[model samples]
Target: MTCQLRVLGCSGGIGGDNRTTAFLLNQNILIDAGTGVADLQLHELRAIDHVFLTHAHLDHIACLPLLLDAVVGARTAPVYVHATEQTIQLLRSHIFNWLIWPDFTVIPSAERPSLIFVPHELGQVEQMGELSVTPLPAIHTVPAVSFLLSSKASSVVFSGDTIGGTDFWQVVNQVASLKALIIETAFADKEHAIADAAKHLCPSTLAKELKEWQGTAEVLITHLKPGESEVTIREVLELDHIHPIRRLLQGEIIEF
Candidate 1:
């Protein structure tokens, strides 16, 4: 069977028709619980069984608490949230402290909690039915990671908000059957300095990263700053690369 991914949101900021990063994998697994999760109906929200967080950034984890609250009554089992140890700690200290949001991990009663935190390390792979999800290295303002989603036939790589670096491509180059690559380029070429400071990528930096990749996967850019998306895409297209790159759109689906 093929693994299907639905892009719920892929924008760097929120605005008209723009949403933060979130992806639905086969209807039950969420790659990130960003603002895009808000668009789902109550019944759709109830279908999420697992959430794999890239980091603890507000834009990435914004809807997680709200999602738990909305689906609590409908869920028969706890929703599993997988992330790095540091990311999980940040969630507990900041988000689920009962001050900012109710600690769903112990809410309704400790015996029947609504959420469970599952910590994963870099390079470790987790199996979800027929799909395999592996955490890859990411350089960001916080402890973050990219994800490699693979089925027996093909694989897709999601480079979560990160700077251009060799470590990520090192792992990505090893995927023999890579079908698609969804990477982030958060700023235009003119904002290269700002992008570097924030540990994000501009078109120029993205070009540098692309040089390390050897596969022929279809490249899709994501996380462009709302107002600067046009310029960013222009600069990305102007770059010299072997693979064709395009912007990732909300509501798009990719099956492999």
Candidate 2:
């Protein structure tokens, strides 16, 4: 089996030409629901059966309501939303609230909701068909989580949106079977103070973070703030202990 990942959105915020963060795993498992989801083909839109939300940030989940609106009428099975209890509550009370967006849960029928929220505790793994996903806590403003997805042949982790931390690095080091790590680097080294204030990682901090991790897995960077991509990549290029440190470009596909 082939495990594919498509970058839907990779920037920190939306500009007239930039998109926020989102990614698709195996075409069926969506990592986030940023503005890029609007690019999905109608048929592709209808095929998404599961969404693994990292948090309730507007930039991370801004497009979910729209995506659900696009496909709710066509899905045979209810879309499963896997997230932390706190994150789910935020979505329910804020984004999906009847005031902001239509509560899709009651759209088709309340008895059998079209969208099912499955709260996942950090550190526990959930099996979804052929994919196994484990939610890991991420250091961010809200109750965010990163993920470790494994199939029979390969496994990788997606760091939703966070600064460098010991917990995620420790978990990655122990995952002997880890093949890749898609982490977020939102700012350049020059913006260290800004990055810190925003609870995001720049290349300088990311280099320090990587120094503490033990492994040679592919280090794929994502969530680069628009217009600062070049500087962030330059800073990453200066790091040691690993090679093939590639930036996660929007619309790019990765097979693990």
lDDT leader:
1
Please provide TM-scores, in order, for all candidate models, with all chains considered together: 0.98, 0.95
Give residue 17's error in model 1 in angstroms: 0.8
Per-residue lDDT of candidate 2, residues 12-87 (tens digit): 7777667788888887889888988878898888888889899999888988888888888788688888889999
All-Cα superposition RMSD per candidate: 0.8, 1.5
Model 2, 228: alpha-carbon shift in Å? 1.2
What local lDDT score does residue 49 receive in model 1, on the 0 to 100 scale? 96
Q: Which stretches of candidate 2 lie over 4 Å from their true place?
A: none
In model 2, residue pairs whose N, Cα or C atoms come closer than 3 Å (at least 3 residues apart or on different chains), thus clashing, are none
For candidate 2, the 10 contiguous residues with the lowest summed lDDT are: 239-248
Question: Which whole-number lDDT from 0 to 100 does residue 35 have in model 1?
Answer: 94
lDDT of 1 at 1: 96
